[model samples]
Target chain A: MIRLHRCCIALLMASAPVAASAASPIELTARVLVEQRQAAADGTTRIVLVPPARVTPGDAIVYTLIYRNTGSQPVPDLVVASPVPGNLLYAGPAEKAAVPEVSVDGKAFAPLAQLRVDGRPAIAADVRALRWRIAAPLTGGAAGQVAFRAIVK
Target chain B: MMNRILSPVALLAGTGAGLLIAPQALAQQVRSGTAAGVSISNQATVSYSVGGSSLTTSSNTATFVVDKKINLAVAELGGTPTIVARGATDQVTTFTVTNLTNATQDFRLEADQQDVSIPLLGTDDFNVTSVRVFVDSNGNGTYEAGVDRATFIDELAPDATVTVFIVANIPDVAGITQANVSLNAIAANSGQAGTLGGDVVATPLTTPDSPTTVDIVFADDTGLLDQPRNGQQRAFDAYRLGSAVVTLRKSARVLSDPVNGLASPHAIPGAVVEYCITVNNAGPNVANGITVTDALPANTDYISNSLTVGGIGTGDTCVLNGSIEDDDAVGADESDPYGGSFDGATVRATLPSVTPLVPLNVGFRVTIR
Candidate 1:
């Protein structure tokens, strides 16, 4: 039984690289963090971000995305796109990025004020997806991250 | 490098169809925020060109569940104070308790007496008797006696409003013009339908989110006395007094006699005597349906067609006004609206309305045998 189990594991390891080579060389990771307000000892309020243990409506959350180019050659035109969940409203970008654009219907991307929904100027709540285009080419073994803040509706 | 398998790239909005394109249209309908126990998932996709070849990959989905938000509102329905007469019973002051939370909940009701003056209402100088709280069982906004008898709300739906009442009895004590009362609604545990739930005393959780377990968060607005996030809310209403204070005085004197006609006479046998009863009202409101009766003395006969009402007078003197009334209780004189009549042994007068600070005098004549 042990020899059979080892043979099955060896066969799985052999096919793993074949699947990885067919996919993109850029690796992406996503995480969700909750924003909490704490009263400091100095009579000041401090905002702390922690992994969500209990999340209620009207709470603020930050979605962070990290990517790295694993290939030997430089990768160009790196674009990161994320959609605002139906249960959440897009507050704004957590950190400024290159050429950030928002979409009201997920198909048309533009600045928040430039986008219109049903003949009216679109607001942050109308945003369904967000995309950012990295201006600089990503060199091999280079890593970067992008984030956005959203409020649970 | 190992990669987790990801779902297909489809950016469809959740639940409602117009949630993405027309949030304003969905807002027009009554709705609260996201409900508890709902899972929210997020994923991101990255695309780039490697060595002149295009490539794309998606990230693993990050998900969390929404906890419960306990919120509600209590409001006095009427802007003006409820007018109540002195010694009035079961006078009702109405309010509305709304469940603003995202889930169905039961609310415990309480009635409290206040001493401070209500806004736009007079100062509260007295307390109402037998104060009680009740929920409107019948959907009607008005409070019905014995019909709307629910004491606490049961399983009230989210964004729904229910009427409540503070039923009390006004004191008969003098100079008590206003009484203030308030209703408080506290969040309570939900139980079987048509049953009052146990009190849900809020001890806010001190720890972080549990992700799988639904935690409670008090998000109610501040009340007149209660602070925000206390799971309770309160509102005040007042009862104003609308009553009349009336006083009566009676006096008699000799008018004339069969032997000394039109001269100074005494209360001797066969002498004609006149009795006057004055009705005065010192009130903040008019007195209605006032009736005064004076019975003749033994061995004395009621003088026919001598009854008079609404006579102008102060002290012991009175001057008869209008036409004279008759001896029979039934006649056009009795329907004069301010008329009097004699029923053999007694002289009776009826006045429909007695204005404030106005004196109404009733007079009749009788002859001693």
Candidate 2:
């Protein structure tokens, strides 16, 4: 009788798919990185990215955003939005694959030329958030990454 | 294709969310930059549509801790060197030590005498004795003799400045005018509120980064005779000699004679002759405790109650605008203030302190036999 009850519970758990299907089909990940200069064997210098062990003022930092489609269907209208931390100053976009739209007040978004801060033209340091939209649809099991550089204030 | 780098002004202008700071506090933060142990976290979100449905997913937060930047500044307080009199003790040259680190720090002070030339002053040619260092214990800018006696700085906060003094004794050396000294301050760990901590050295680059521990970095700029990234700074000052250059001039003038009356005075018998001794100090320092001695001329009688001191001197004669003194030197009239007295054959006069702008005069009258 105990085995029959355990089997009945397993059958009930195995039939529950409606609640799990409501989850999002895209996976997002973020990372912070720093660049280091190394003397190569060819008597040349090479720049490489690594995880920062310590961060101080005036140090340049990179924030990378990666997205992967995990569902069986393709995901369309994929938009990635990231807010610049208060203690970090936005330097510029690290990747040139897609130009990101920035917002100073987190309400209105536009190109770098159309934004203003305190009634003056906004520089890259005044950016509060950045958004990048993929021009093509992301297929199932496909991944893409976007990155930007910021300085520790 | 457009790239913009962050400027230093924008980095130090303002920070934090909804945090209001005063102008002075903002300036202090600019020196130390971001505080240590501050956590900076960032997260990204992605939103997409699938079959007429919208879904959103957020990334894991990526965070890093700000490390401690050990830095400090030492500066001489005054532009000109300290003026010290010869044989002066406990003369102080002031300096200010400012903590530019991101956290509270203790500073170890060292006062050293160098033979290098000080700016605007000549080369150091003498050595000072009993050199010592002191910190301002009461947060006051002035250096008190016995009150502010703390040697090393205790628990100095970021962007906060404290007064330091290098006190020494000036020797009475001839032909020696300037002595140069330097004050060096090294960053240290802050142990307690009123206690000094151990010295802090630069963290080696070979040490691996531990996410939980706050690493140390030397960010101090180069100072006088000090290297960069050493968590220390040094500044130089000098002590200039202040001495008196006194000049004495003596003159004699005939007052009156019994034969010629007051019309034509001559050095004849029964004539009163007055001798004037004028002392002038022309150096940058004042002279004190000056005494003038003059012997009566041969075959001359000393006039009683006619000796006076501290009078004004003109071109060649002494103006008798001084107090009268008796013939004896053991009475109250001799030193009531400024006076002179005659003792049988010689005259002695004592005057007050002589300054650079004023001349002290001593005058006495003698009768020719």
Report the number of the highest-DockQ candidate.
1
In model 2, the number of clashes is: 0
Q: Model 2, which residues run further than 4 Å from truth?
A: A1-22, A37-48, A95-99, B1-27, B118-121, B243-369
- TM-scores of the candidates in the order shown: 0.75, 0.69
lDDT of 1 at A13: 56
Model 2 chain B lowest lDDT segment of ten: B1-10
Colliding residue pairs in candidate 1: A53-B209, A53-B210, A54-B209
Give the count of colliding residue pairs in each prediction.
3, 0
For model 1, how does the per-residue alpha-carbon lDDT over A1-153 read when each residue is reduced to its tens digit? Answer: 999999987885553222234546787778899999999999999988887766777889999888888776778999888888878888898856343598876667788989986678988877888888887998889989898989888
Candidate 2: C-alpha RMSD to true structure equals 11.7
Candidate 1 residues B1-369, lDDT tens each? 112212211444343246645657456322557877788988787878776775667776778887778888999997878988878899999999988776788999999998777655667889999998889999898888889888999999877899999999988775577788888999887757888778665535676547667777788888678899988999888888777778899888899987888688877899998888889875557899999887787988888888888877688756756457787777787787777877677778888888776788888878889
What would the per-residue lDDT of candidate 2 be over residues B1-369, giving only the tens digit for each residue?
001112211332344223233535544565777788888887677777888776667677788888888988899998778988768899999999999888889999999999776555567888899999999888777788889999999988888899999999988654467799999999988968777788896667899887556789898898668999998999888888776767789988889999887778999999999888888875456788888888888998888787878877766678755677787777787657786777787888887688775777888888899
lDDT of 2 by residue, A94-133 (tens): 8563568987765567998898765679888678778898
Q: Which stretches of candidate 1 lie over 4 Å from their true place?
A: A1-23, A95-99, B1-17, B20-25, B28-31, B116-120, B201-203, B243-369
State residue B281's C-alpha deviation in candidate 2, in Å. Answer: 8.6
